[model samples]
Target: MSGLWDIRLEGSLETLSPFCVIAPGAEEVTRANGGKYRRISRRTLYRDGLRDSRPVVPGSTLRGRLRRSAVEVVRILSGERMPLAQWHQNAIGGIKGSDSEAAFDVQLRITLREKNPVLALFGAGSPWMTGRAAIGDAIPEGPVETDLIGGARSDDGRRDGMLFERLDADAAEQWHAMADANAARTRYKKAMRDLNATLRAARKGGGPEEVARLEAELADLVRCEEAAGLMSTNPVSMPLLHEAMPVGVRMRHRMMLTAVTEAEAGLFLAAMNHWMRSKPALGQHESLGYGLLRGEYDLWLSPAGAGDPFSVGQAQALPLGTMTAEPIAGLSGVPERLAGFMAAFREAFRSGAFDFRLASEIG
Candidate 1:
C-alpha cells in the first residue's frame, strides 16, 4: 500500500544521559589541540552552510549505528553463531553464491547489480545512483547546553582514565594533610598572636617589624589551608572527561524517499525499531551513560494536503507535518519480494551466515 509518499519522522530524541555528537571541525577544542572539543560550547556544522548552535547527531552516524544495531537483532534471532566477518559478507554479498543469507543477491544482479533492491536502498558501491533511503541529520528541537563529564578515556587518548585517578590521589593527600595539620595550624596562629601581643606591650625596637613578617607568614598559611579544603572537595571521580553534548535536546529526521516498496520500507523501519527499542547508545561516552536515546517512528503514505494521508506510527506519539511533493512510496510488488529478501537475510543471520559484531568487540 505505497504510492508517492514521503516519511517524515518527527520526535524528541530524549537523552537518558549527557550525550555528545560533535565533529572535529566545530567542536570546542583545547588550544594547540589541532582539533576542537570541549573548552567551550559552539555551533556544530552538519554540512556546509548548515551549522547548528548545538552539536547535532549526524545522519550517517545514526545510520551506521542503526545498521550495527540491526546486527544484534540478527544475532539474537540467530543465537550467537554469526560473527562480524561472516555477517557483513551476507549483508553486503562479499561471499560466494551458495550463501542464501546474503542480503543482496549479487549473483542475481550481475546484469544490473546497481538495481539490486537492498544495495540500491543503501547506495552500495556508489558511482551509479543515489541511495533510496534519504535519512537526514537530527537536530535539537529546543535549547541545548553543554556539560562536562569524565568518560573513561580511550586507547587513543580521547579521554584518559588515569586523569581521575591522579586527581583523586592529590585530593586525598591534600585532604589528609589539611586534617592532620589543622591543630598545628591553630597553635601556630595562637603563638603568633601571643608574640604580637607581647611585642606590642614591650614597645621594643624591631618588635613591630618582626611581628609584621610573622603576620604575613600566618596569612600565607591561612591561604594554604583554604586551598587544601577546597581541593579536598574536588571531584575525584573518573579521569577522562570532555565537554559533552547537552542532553534533553529534541530531534527529528525527515527521511524522504523517491520510490520504495513495502519490503524495503519494512526492513528499514524494522532495523530502526531495533535501535529505538534497544538501549544501545549513539555518539560518544556510551560507557559513561551518555548518548542513550529514545524516539518514535512514523510513516506517511503521502505528503499532507494530497487528500488525507495514510500513515502508521510505531507508538502513540506521532510527529506530523507537511513535506515536499517530490518524493513518494511505491504501492505495487513490494511486500512479496522484500519479504523473501528479509526472510533469507534473517535466515542467513540466524544460521550464522552473517557474524554479528557487538559494541564491546569494536576496536
Candidate 2:
C-alpha cells in the first residue's frame, strides 16, 4: 500500500483540423508576400537508421492542455471563481528564490500533499515538490503532411471616404467613436507604462511617501482604464498565414503516472475524461477552427514492490475507452476497481477531505 502505482496511458491523437503549435518568436515573416507564417513545432528523431527532423506536438503543449483542463474541472466541481491564488504554483510549479525559506520542511510538504491532490500529483515549487505525471512528445506515426493556410482581416473602412458617404450618419459617428477609443487606449497604455516605471523607481530608492503616491496613482489609472474599456478598434487589413499539419494526421501519445494512489489516479483520469468529452481545441488559432483533436487511449496499471521499486509487476489493463459522464461521480461501464477509485475521489471531494485554498496559503 505504501509502494508506488505506475499508470501508463497510451493513445493516438488524430487531428480533426489543421493544427499548428508554434513556439514563441518561431514565426517566419515573409518579405515577398508581406505575410506571417508559423510552422508546427518540430524535433529531431531517428527512424530506420536515419536522423530526421519532423513536425511534432511537444510534450509541454500536451501537459499544458491537460493542466488547464484539470484546473477547469476542479473549478467547476468546487464552484469557485478563483480556486487557487497561483495556478502556476499549484498545477505546474514555482521555484523558491534565495530570499525564500528552504523546502526542507518535510512535515509542511506532507501536509500540503495530503491537503491538495492536485499539488500532490502535479507538484509545487515552494518546497521543491516533484510531479508524478509525465507526458511524452506526440510523434507522428507516418509522414506528417503540412500545408499553409491564409487568412485576411477586412479594412476598418475609416480611410475610405466613399464608403463612409454611403453609410448612414449614425454608422459614420460609430466609426469616429471607434477611432477615438483606439487613440484613448494608446494614450492609456503609454501613461500606464510611464507610471509603472516611476513606481519601480520609487520602490527602489525613493521615500515611502513617494512610493505610496505612485501606488495610488497606479491604482487610479487602472480604474480609469477599466472604465474606458479595453478593446481593439480601427483594425487594418492584415494577412495571416500558418503552416499546419493537415487533418487525419495521427500521432502517438503516452502519459505515465508514477507513485499515484487510486484516488489520485481517479482524479487525473477524470480530468482526462472531461477533456475528451469537452473536445477542447489545442495549439493555436482555436478561434479560426484549428487544433481540434480526437484521442483514443488504453490504460494500464503496475504496482511496484517495496524491495525493488523500479521493478514493475504484471500490468493490469483497464480498457475504459473515452466514455465517462461526470468528472468523478458518473463513471459508467468501467471496471469495479476503477469505479471504486472514482467513488473514493468523489467522497473525498464531497467531504472536503482536500483543502481547496489558494496556493499562496501553502507554506
Candidate 3:
C-alpha cells in the first residue's frame, strides 16, 4: 500500500478486439501469476488535457508484462541457429523466426506493446520511477520513516513525483542507446544476407570460369564482413559498429534493481501478438514491440539444454532463486525523500510485489 499510486499511461492501441487479452490467463503461465495491461483504444489522444482514466493502464505494469514477453519471443524467434531458409525449404512459413510475411509483423507487435506505453508514460510525466534510478541527492540521512497513522514527509521537501521524473530521465537515456544499437545490427544483417544471396545465385552459371568468378566475388564479400567486423567467432554474431554515445544520452545510470522473470515475458508476448494480429494497420509503431524485446532479452536468458531449442521453457524450468530487495535510495542522486519512495516501489518489485485488485470499473 505504501508504494501504490494512481498512475495512468497514455498510448494508442493498434487493435480494437476485446477478445484479445494482452496478459495470459494463468499465474503459473505468467511471471506474476497474471499479466497487466491497459485497454488502449483508438480514441486516446496524443496531447489532450486530462483524458478519461477509465481505459488507462500503469506503465510499470505494462513494462513488466512486455519485458517478459519480449525475452520469450526472442528466445523462440532468434535464439536458435534455425534459419528462415530452412523453413522455406519445408514450406513452413508459420514458424516464429521464419522469414515469412508474418514474422516481421509478429516481432513488430512485441516491440509496440513494449515501447508505446513506456514512451507515453514518460512523455506524459507519470508519477512512477523505473526499477533502477532515484531522486536527487539533496536529502537527509537514512531511509525516510513513514508513520502508520500520520503520514511522514518524503526525504526531500518535494513530493514523490519528482523521484519518478528523475528515474524516467535516466531510463530514457539507456533505453535509446540500446535500441539504436539493435536497430543497426538488424539492418546490417539484412544487408549481408542480401549480398550473400546475390553471390550464391551468380555461382549457378555451372562453368569453371563462372565458378572462379563467383569464388572471387565471394572472397570480396568475406573481406567486407571482416572489415565491418560482423564475422565473429561467436555463434550469435553482431557487427562491431563504432558508435559514439549519442549526444544528450546519459550512460552512467545504475543497473536494474527489479529482475524480471521469463514467465512474465511470455505473457507479454502473447498479449502483444494478440494485439498486433487484431490490428494490422499500425505498422511501424507495432514493430517497436520487438525492439523493446531486443532491449530486455538479457534479463531472462534461457539455459543451455533446457530444450531442443533455447526458449522460455528453459527459463521457466530454471529454479527461481531468492528475490532480494535493494535500497533504491542513492542511485539517481535525486532528493532523499523522493529517492526513498522510488526505491521502495522498485525494492518491492525485486521482492515479488504486486498491486491487489481494488474497485472494478466494468459495469
Candidate 4:
C-alpha cells in the first residue's frame, strides 16, 4: 500500500445547446445592469497582492463535486448511505435532510474508523468527504461566453437520454453506431438467404439457360454481400448534430490522488470517467442544459515516499508498479491507526468497499 498517483485530466467541451452556470444575482437582476448571471472562467488580477486564479469552478468545487459523484458510485457499489448533497455538500445540490425522520441532533455520533474501502478512498464521518483525491480548478483554454434565455426548470430529469435523442456528440455517435450495425447485419443476412433460395430453385428445375441466369443472379447477390461487408467495416458516419454549441469552448483540468489499494485508485478513475462520459459537469445551472464535456484522464503513479511526487514528469495511463495492501487481521475494536485507516485517507475515500454498477453508472 504505497504507490499513489497524481492524475491529470485534459479535455475540451461544447454544449449541445445554450446553457448557463447560474451565477448569483439580485431579485431584480437584468442583463443591462450586470445582475444577470453569466458564464465565467478561472482568472486573476494583480490588484490583489499575491494573485490567485478566481476559477469558474474552483478546486474545492471541482474536487467536491467529483468526489461526490465518486462517492455516489461507491455508494451504489458498496451499498452504503453516502448522501448526494450536504451542509454535507454534494454536487447534486439543494439538500434538505434525507428521508430519515430523525432530527440532526439525534444522529449517531460514534465515528468508526473502519478499514471500509469507500471510507479509505473518500473521507467519511464528516459533513464533507474530502477524499483521497484533490482535483485542481479547471482553467479555461478559451473564452466562456454566456447566453440568456428563460423557462429554466429542473423537471427535465433525463439529460443524458436527451443527449443521445438530441445532440450528436461522441455519446450520440456511439448509440447510432450500435443501431446501424444491427440494421446492416439484418439486411446482409436477408440478402444472403434470398440468394440461396434462388440458387436452390434453379438447380431443382431448369436447363442450362435458366441455371446460367440463376448463377448470374447469385453473382449479383455475392457483390451485394461484398458491399455489405464493406459497409459493416465502415458504417456511414453521422455528423455531430450540435447546433447548440458555441465557438471557443474548452478547459484543462488536473487532479492528484493517494491510494493504498488498487480499488481506491480504480474507483477514482471510474468516477471521473462516468461523469465525463455522461457530460454531467461544466459548471452549475445544469437544469437549463449547461455543463456537458467529453474527456479522458492520464495517470502517473509514484511510491509514497518519492522525493518529488508533485512534479509529475511523464506520467502515463497506468501506475509504474502494482501495489497491494496486506490483509488486516481483525475488525473487533476501535482505535484506528493504519490498523485499518478510514481516516487520514483524504476526504473523498472513506465510506465503504467499491461495488461499481456499470450498467446504471458507467453505461
Candidate 5:
C-alpha cells in the first residue's frame, strides 16, 4: 500500500490538423500536423479490488471511462445487474466459467460539476469550445436508466440511491490508525518467529558454550520484539505463517463505498487533493508539459458542497476557464472521517461482503 499516489488533469491538447499535398506529378501525401492533446490519466497503486486512490480511477483520463468504473463498483456493491458495455454483454452474460460475476457487476458513477459556468465548457479538440467528449450530458443525473448509447431503460435498475451518509472525520482517522497498528504488529510477530528459529538452531547444534551464546541471541530478539510492542501473540497475529505475506496480507488491500458521511468523504477527497498537489504532482505534470500549451498552473482542493448539494467537480481547460479538481465531500478537517472510511471497507471485505481470499502459505 506504500507507494506514490497520483491523480492529475491534463488539457489543452493540440488538435491534429489533417492536411493533403499534391506534387506536379500528381503524387499526393496526407499527413497529420498536430500533436495529441494531453489527457488526464491517474497513476496509483492497484491493490485489492480497487485502485490505490480514494475514488479509484487513475488509468482513465476521459470522464466517460472514469464514470464507467464508478458505475461498475456501485452496481457490484448494490447486488444488481449492471448496465453492459458493447463488449461487456458478451463477457458479462452469466456464463458459469466466464470472468464476469453477476454480483461483481455493480458500478458507481462519478460526475464533476463546476460552480463557474465558464470552467464547465473547456475542450481540447474545440479549443475554447466545450466539447462533449467524455462527461457530456451522458453523465447521468444521479444514476438513472437513460441509455448511454441508445435510449434504453431498466425497470430493475434503481435510479439514484443515496450511497453514503456523512460521518465524523476525526473518528475515521483514529480507526484507520488502530487498524494499521494492529496490522503492523501482526507482521512483526511472524518476523520474530523466523529470527527465533535461528537462535534455537544454534543452541541445538552447539555445546554448553553454544547454549549460552544462543540464549543471549534469544534475549536480544525478545527485547527487540517487545520494543516494537509485539511481545504477546494476539489472536489477530496468530495466523501469520505465509511466504507470500505481502500479497496475501489484508494490509495490502483497500475498499471504497459511497455510504460515508459528508465529513468522512471530504477527508478522503482532501487527502487525495493534498497527495496529488504535493511535490509529486510536479513530476507527473512535467511529463505532459507539451500538451498544456500556455496557462497559469495551480491545484486547489474544495468540498463538493456546503450550500448546494448538487454541485460536483468538473474539468475545463480553455481561454476563459480551465481544468478543476474533483469535488470531495467533508469540509470540516476532522480526521475521524478517514478512520470511518477505512474501518467500513475493512470490515465489509473481512466479513466477506466481497469475494476476496488470501493465498495463505501452506507450509
Candidate 6:
C-alpha cells in the first residue's frame, strides 16, 4: 500500500550580511569610466492598483541552492561514492544528450522513480516529469534598501593587505602577461569581425577560393581569441561596484510539496536539516562576507487519511531557526515530529529505498 501527504513551509529570511543576486545583463563595463558594476535582480508587481518594481530572490535560484544541499545530504547519508555529475543530473534534471533522448521511454522513468527517491521528488526533464516540490521567490516584507559597495583589485597585491614594497617579480610578470593577453583578445575580435564581413562579401560575389581562405582565417582567429580569453585577466587597481541589499533586509518565502510519500518528504526534510546545519548562504560573493542569511519557518503537514500507512498527524507546527545555537532537544514544540520524519527517512534508507545504481541508467 502507498500513501501521500501535502506539506507546506512558510518562512522568512533575513540577510545577516550584504546580498546581491544581479539582474540578467545588468553587469556591464562602462566605456566612459572603464569600471564594471552589477545591479540587483528585480521584478515588477502590482499592489494597490499601482505598478512597482521590487528586488526579488528568484525561485529558480532558491531551488538550485536547495537541490545542491539536498544532493550533499544524499551523498553523506547514503554513504555511497556515486558519480556526482550523473547523480546530479538524475536528481536535478539535466539534458543527458539530446532533449528527446528519453522521449519514448516510459518504463525507464517509472523504474527511475522506484529506485531513486531523490529523483522521484525532484523530477527530471529528458522524460518530461513533474517534481513534487515548488519554491516561491523571496519577496521583501517591507521597503527594500540597497547600497552601492565598491572594491578594487591591485596588481601589486596592496589591496589584499600586502605592502607595495614587498611586491614580487612574478606579480609584475603576471600583470604584463595579462595585459598583453587582453590586448591580443581585442585584436583577435576586431580581426574576426573584419574577416566575417569579408567572408560575407565573398559569399555574395567573390570566388570560392577567397571564401575558403577567409573562412580558414576566421576559424584560426576564433581559436586565438579563445586562447587569449583564457589568459586575460581583469584590469587591476580599478574599482568594481555592486548594488546590493544591505543587512537586516527581511524577505518572505514559501515552499510546497504536493502528494509526496513519507520517505520522500523525509528525504527533503533531511536535506533542509543539512542545509540549516551547514549555515547556508545565498545570492553572491559569499567569500566577500555577503549573502549570509538567517531563516525562520513554520511547517505544516496535512493529515493522512485514516488506515493509511502514513503516521504523521494534521496541523503539526515545526519552527525552524537556521542560526540558533540551541540543540534540537532543547527547542520547544516540534522536535518529536521532526525526529519522526527523520527516522522514517533513515529507515527507508536502511531498507534500500534509494538505489544509486539507477543513476547511470537515467537519461
* Model 3 CA lDDT for position 70: 32
Q: Model 5, range 63-132, lDDT digits (tens) per residue? A: 3222333333334444656333311321221123333333331221011111111112112111122321
User: Which portions of model 1 miss their true places by more than 4 Å?
Assistant: 1-6, 24-28, 31-52, 71-118, 126-129, 150-239, 303-363
* Cα misplacement distance, residue 6 of candidate 3 (Å): 67
Candidate 1, residue 19: how far the Cα is off, in Å: 0.8
Ten residues in sequence with the least summed lDDT for candidate 3: 242-251
TM-score for each predicted model, relative to the true structure: 0.47, 0.70, 0.17, 0.43, 0.18, 0.70
Best TM-score among the predictions, by candidate number = 6
* Candidate with best lDDT: 2
Between candidates 2 and 4, the one scoring higher on TM-score is: 2
How accurate locally is residue 212 in candidate 2, as Cα lDDT from 0 to 100?
Answer: 94
Query: What digit string (tens of lDDT, one per residue) describes model 2 on residues 1-363?
Result: 134567777877777788889988774755453455766798777888998777878888877767766676777788877634456555666545564556367787777777777777777666567778888888888776678878766655755668877878788777767667767876786788789989999899999999999999999998887777754343344455679888888888888888777767777767766665674577888887887776666666666333354545532433444432332233345556566666777777888887746444755
Q: Model 6 reaches what TM-score against the true structure?
A: 0.70
- Report the Cα lDDT for residue 288, model 4: 48
Candidate 4: tens digits of C-alpha lDDT, residues 1-363: 334444333333334434233334412333432223333444563444775543344566555555665656655554556433332423332233344433322222112112333444455433223356566655556444443444322222133446555544576657566656756765775676776777788788868898898788878867876776644464333211111224235556666665445445555545554455443545555664555544333334444444455655454234332211111211122222222323323333444222222111211
Question: How far off is residue 78 in model 4, in Å?
Answer: 4.3
Winner on TM-score (3 vs 5): 5
What is the lDDT, from 0 to 100, of the residue 326 in candidate 4? 13
lDDT of 3 at 144: 22
> Alpha-carbon error at 39 in model 4, in Å?
6.4
Per residue, candidate 1 scores C-alpha lDDT tens digits across 1-363 of 233334444444555567766555543544342223454323364545665575566777776765555445555665557655545532443333352434544444332322233443554332222456777777766546777554432322224545445565466556555545544554554665665666565555557777677667666756775675642342322235477666566676566544654434555655665665564577766766777665544434543234433534433223343221110121222234334545655544344432223211321
Candidate 5: which stretches are off by over 4 Å? 1-59, 62-97, 103-259, 262-264, 279-363
lDDT tens string, model 3, 104-203?
3444333332332221111111111122111111111112221111122232313343554567556656645544555655666666666566666766
- Predictions in order: lDDT: 0.50, 0.70, 0.30, 0.45, 0.29, 0.68
RMSD of each: 16.1, 11.5, 26.8, 23.9, 27.4, 8.1
